[model samples]
Target: MKVPFSPPFIDQDVINEVLSTLESGWITSGPKVKALEEEVCKLTSVSHTVCVNSWTSGAILVLKWFGVKEGDEVIVPAYTYSATALAVIHCGATPVMVDINEDFTVDTSKIEQAITNKTKVIMPVDIAGWPCDYDAINELVNAPSRIKVFNPESEKQKQLGRILVISDAAHSIGATYKGLQSGNLTDITIFSFHAVKNITTAEGGAICLNLPESFNNDEEYKLMKLFTLNGQNKDAFTKSQAGGWKYDILFAGLKVNMPDICAAIGLAQIRKYNDLLLVERERVARRYQNFFSQYSFFQLPILEDKERKSCFHLYALRINSISEEKRDLIIESVTKTGVSVNVHFIPMPMLTVFKDRGYKIEDFPIAYDNYSREISLPIYPQLTDDEVDYICTAILTSYKKVIQSND
Candidate 1:
């Protein structure tokens, strides 16, 4: 039997909930969507949450709402999906990519080097469901302005707003970092509820406003609400009101609203989250650690190490002391044995767009080394013990064949 990689764990509960929503007919950003947003609010302990169709849109919208525009620079990690940097570009801002630590987190030491007078935001991605060092990032944001920032191109002179810490926490939804939820760890946190993510909303995302006391997220929320729906003053809720059909165009906001269907799926998922889903994932992670503990050729994903707890999103195993070519061959071998797998990223600088933008792969050596031989194994709540065993067996058998062949 073939074992596919991560898939949604839908049950009768999820099906019934979705059907109930379908039958309700008050769908498409209605009461049900509002309830889901509230549920997210409680879960993250954040004051405000704006649900969107995807994490990319959430990230982009946050930057745009914060007035991140042309001539502004945002810092992003090199060892992340292209979406992390692409969203910054969507806001017409420059993405200064930084290298990652040995654990594949955005290296805190390197972040300071990329800051300029043009730097307005620091977009730190929770790579592999682990939070980047928030305290270090906050310190950088609070440091006395010392980066001799100069502006030559702007006629209207742009000033940096201290630093906005944007957390691209696509993989981490139920994750906790330093006794705080992932959503509450930064200025703005964007979560992915995609099929592959820990929390599956099918194809959706949420923007958490965990701002300081000075920043009132409610006003920003209204703007974002208007922004997502064609820059109109009224959303579907207001338009549905009696004699409130007419609305005015505020700003040219993009269409990125999440429907009740998507929210229904998310609502269903969150119901059993603390009761069952997170526990199961945690168990599976421990099992993987136990199984791979003795393997010298393997360096498992750093989930719980040196003060960090991952959401266990991806079982990224590093091919210790192996060439990238051999790693490819090993992955191919595993695939032949009825197990499905993939890689997390390809280091943005190596991508065509990033390379063309004058970023060199050599600039991020640590990120390159980490990416060269990492294979993301199947990880999801639905994965069973038998399936896990088969996956592990296939991996070990492939490793023996490849390593022995090389020896």
Candidate 2:
């Protein structure tokens, strides 16, 4: 009767892959990692993939690669996990937080107003596996007025010629927007393979290179590899070759390379993604929607649109018109009933760190409104139908209790 939030689907295939990796002797960022990157390229239809230790690392690497530093600005949604904004801060750049739409994605209409000569990156997060409107965001970024506003600081930025759209697609991998996969939806997209994500590699992430046609992805991939390995000229795999001990230091780089061990899991997960994980997650989500639709208060997470489709990563069920206090009460009651639920996020301004940085919750009304009532239900490939029913009943009962108490 106990329903945990999200657990990695580690079957025999994952274990065997890891076992083979452990036996291979060359376990650190070697053949298996390369294979995983190739598989990701095939899955997302991107030209290059750079596997990293985490999505935060990948985001930071991209920021560094484009020479985002002190005084620059990176626009991000206020509703996303702090990683999105923290990536900007780590690069010594100011994170210009923007409010989100009702869909819990960045409000593209307001993006242009936030753009300035200092704006270098616009990171749109695909919250809960649902992709934001990339086409709209892209048009805004590439608009004539906005392009004129951009002032390139680095050689890489000048080459790009405009603001770079890096998708914070941490929750969306198998997702689609306007018939394009998550990676292809933006100029560049970073994916997370953390344990709770729809597809997991225990703790890993990747940067899908989808830069503009004028940019050389292959060259960028090579540079990223160098940047990730402490600015070393060669990785451990390359140095393992005979007479390859003499390597040169390229420059100061971040140590965020993914090892073969995590890549082993990523390979297995990506291989079986569409057939098993995606199907089961979608099935569970549909069942939840069917059951919850009978209630007036439930505002289900977006599953699909004409131009977009979620990977069904998280069922972010919302209780409309509820106060933050009542929402917490419902979660408490549901937990007592043996079903665990979690909020997708707390808006940036509400967080103590960002608050101290002069961001006020009142500035982002839409994001805070969504955050107050959102409760992410259990939706994973391993969840059973019986568990789904139990979750529904618990939520309904708990929600009614909170509503009646308020009345």
Q: Please report the candidate that would top lDDT against the real structure.
A: 2
Candidate 1, 162-183: lDDT as tens digits: 6778899998887787778889
Model 2 spans with C-alpha error above 4 angstroms: none
Each model's lDDT comes to: 0.84, 0.92
TM for every model, in the order presented, reads 0.95, 0.99
Give the alpha carbon lDDT tens digit for every residue of 127-205 in model 2: 9999998889999888899889899989999998999999999999999988889898888999999989877778889
Candidate 1 local distance difference test against the native = 0.84
Candidate no. 1 TM-score: 0.95
C-alpha positional error of residue 353 in candidate 1 after TM-score superposition, expressed in Å: 1.7
lDDT at 403, model 1: 88
Stretches of candidate 1 off by over 4 Å are 146-160
- Candidate with best TM-score: 2
